[model samples]
Target: MGIPGGSAPSTRLLLLPGTLGAGLIGLSLWLGLSHGTPLRCFSGVAVGLCFVSAGIAAWRLRPRSRTGPWMALLGLVVLTSHLNDGLMLPTSMSGRELITLFGTPANWLQVPVAELLFLAYPSGRLRTTAERRLVTGAFALGAVAAMVMLATKTPVPICGGWCGPSPLQLVADPQLYLRLRSVFMTGTVVLAAAALALLIRRGIRSTPRQRRLLRLITLAAGLTVLLFAATQLFIVAVYTGRTGITPTVFLFETLTSWLAAITLPLAFLAGLLRQRLAFASVGTLVGRLEHVAANTVEAALAETLRDPTLRVAFPTEQGWIDVSGHLFHPPSDGSQLLTPLGDPPVAVLVHDPSLSEDRQLLDAAATAVRLSLENARLHAQVQAQLTEVRASRQRIATAADTERQRLERDLHDGAQQRLLGIGLTLGLLRNRVRGTTGRRLVDELERELCTAIGELRDLAHGIRPAVLTDQGLAPALAGLARRSGICVHLDVQVTERLDPLVEITAYYVVSEALQNIVKHADRADACVRAVHRAGWLVVEISDEGPGGATTASSSGLSGLADRVTAVGGQLQITSPPCGGTHLRAELPCA
Candidate 1:
């Protein structure tokens, strides 16, 4: 059956030669063993081995198989043929005896068939398409020659009817037959030589080791073909009656055949060894480079992570380094913090089984990064706690101010009103009694009540502004400006209303700054401007006064700054060389 799934054309072509070679070997073995020809038996064994080798090489497609087995089989055939001739089996055996035992119809067919089959094996290994076609054409021509010779010639009986010599020998004259055989042998030799030359040229252009192996194989193939040609020439010479076959020629053929057989296998083994060595060396080098690259990357990552303000990153396609992880620094205002290893930034995010996670001397930098991050987290938490505490204190201060305002209102409405009413009643009684002493006592009482009322009003104003609750921050600031006597210029531009607490806070800030200017600045004129800009209420107060004013030197201004800071607002004081004090406060409006 054909190979399954329709084998490659090359494989199909190779199979034909292999099958024919096997059939030849089987026939040769049967004839040699049955007829008791030791020379034939040995030739059969060698041919069998060659078939096996060629079959294996065809399957493997290894370079060495081209010459190795063919040379071996050719050597065995030459030796066996010569030995058979020397032994004179045909001359010694009686016709009846040879026919009954040694000579058989099968034996007659085996010899030429084996030789033809052997010739076809090398065709499969031809290098180029041209070479392959040439070799195939030669084999076809040889087959045609054999067929024509068989058709024209009559069979000549050798040892009775059991076996015979080639019919061509009987029909054609010896000279003409020898010339035909010489042409056949020469053509085959030339084809083989051409193939060998192509292989050698290919090898020469290859790597040094491969070239050496190929050259050796080519040499073996060439020598085998040369020896075969010499044997054919010697036979042709004998047929032509020029000279008898010489022992020296036979010896040379035998030696060269053996040499070809041994060299072929050696060449193949050498090439295999060279290929394995080269690949193994390459694998070792790649492994080392990979290890070095991994180590270098790890070290770099560790170094970057160890620094507080530094971050580790990976190169992007646009040649920018993207942050992969960071240590010690707070998250940037506009920029984001690096998360845990993901994507390109951290190349080796997955944990490797070979690597240790435990803290060690070699991993000190990585360990340091972990510690610093933890410390930074704890510091942030502590700051949050302090902020909460400050907020609690401010809440308490506001509550105390509310209580003071209530107390002041109670005194003004109850005790101070009651005293004024009593003084008025006393004045009316004295007028009814018509006494100067009573009137004088009533007037003194009235005067004391007035003083008490004035002190209570001052206390209420100090506790909290009635003006801030009655109107918005702008009107209160305007009232302050009107009262300041320092030519206070008010510019309030806040349109959207704010939280009561924020409005009060802004009012207080402006009031404190104006008071500072009046007390310390000694300025002739001052400007108070409050504008809402970029989600902040920006208040700027400037006075043309003697400079050199500082928050540290003035407790009130310093306290005002602290209060503003507590609410996440900034207060700046600038006293310039021109004897002007400028105070700027920015408070978040929302």
Candidate 2:
């Protein structure tokens, strides 16, 4: 039972029975017709027995079926017909006597009843019990009708001779006799034709193996109908006084009947062989589908296991191809399996062995899994790089802060203290000199020394504000606002102490913003506010200005933004329509 087109060992064995049956039919037909010795009758009987034997063997070999009994019945009928003809025909009559005997109702009935038995051969493999009973009943009815017609008949022309008394003449009712004959002949032809047509139509729509079985059954049925029809037509021609039973008609009827009788058993054998082949084909196809499905499952499993983000889906409940892998699952026995990919846990379903074979699909799935793993690895590397960059920026900010503090100390201890000492010496010199010229010179020198001390203090404050250390960010910003000669409001909402570096960064952002406002805002008042929210210190400095402030043109503000960002803070400047500018900074408090 291989696939119809596959090269399999069982196909060879399947062809053997049909071949042998055909050969046996051909050999038997040649021996029975070509030879004319007394042994010819024995040979015909032997050939008929062979046909019966083959049919019986075919029936027995098939599954327990109604077809088996039907075939067995057909074989028995053929054997009895041959045996009866052999024993009675030649022994009872010479050539002229045989021609005369053929006119008898019994002879006509025997031939038709035997022909009707051929119908059972093809349907012998797997018919239901009901169908078998119906067929048997039909055969019994046909046999009874033939017997009844034989029992009551009047003289009727048959092939230029007379069959007397013919059943129609003896019935004494011409209409009833015509009706019965017409009905019986028409029904048999119609039923046989319909059965053959249905078998052919079914074969055309079936798989190759089924087509073969149907072909055997249909061929058998067709031969039986052809032989029966020829016999009926000859009877009609002879009875209507249209033609004689010439040698040609006799030869044709004998040859056709013998061909049909021999082929019937072969047809049964062919049908049985076809059934075995069909079963084998189905098994093979099932195995192939299972193999394909297993491969798909393995591939999907490997991919999902390797990468959490990757998924696979099946489009049909059972088929060879998968339509979408991004979202699909295997069908569940009692639970719902079909769901979107984003659903929680994103379960991976196990494949059924019946649906597919698991081993063949693993390599491609493994490759996909590897690729998903690589993608995940690359993402982790990117995050690590970002963390490293952030740490580097923090280190740079710390170094910058240390350098600024050192410079502020150098200016305050070295430059500012020296300038103050020089101013004190100049003041003493002014006191010592009494003359107007000396006193004026000393006072001018003291005034110049005091101006130098003030400039140095301003420079030290710019490097690292003294007020930021002494009074915190809010007052330093407010003092700078006052120095700028702008009306400023300070709102300090944060009460918790922050990291020193964070405070410095916030103060610088405010100072730079206010300086920009005073130099370029061309407006009246400004407000500064600081608040702590969600572990961050937020500083907002707004001003009533001309309101076209831009970070791109303000280098000081841009530099302050960089410094704020270096300490892990953000700066935003919004200058809206009308006269207003807003600068906000958010810094981590921890």
Error of 1 at 493 (Å): 2.1
Residue 10's lDDT in candidate 2: 42
lDDT of 2 by residue, 455-518 (tens): 8888899888987877777677667777877788888876666777888888788778777877
- Lowest-lDDT window of 10 residues in candidate 2? 353-362
Quick one: RMSD of model 2? 23.4
C-alpha lDDT (0 to 100) for residue 324 of candidate 1: 22
**Among these predicted structures, which one has the highest TM-score?**
2
Q: How many clashes show up per model? A: 0, 15
The sequence of per-residue lDDT tens digits that candidate 1 reaches over residues 462-538 is: 55667766777788788878877678888999776775556666877777878877787674688889898778988
Candidate number with greatest lDDT:
2
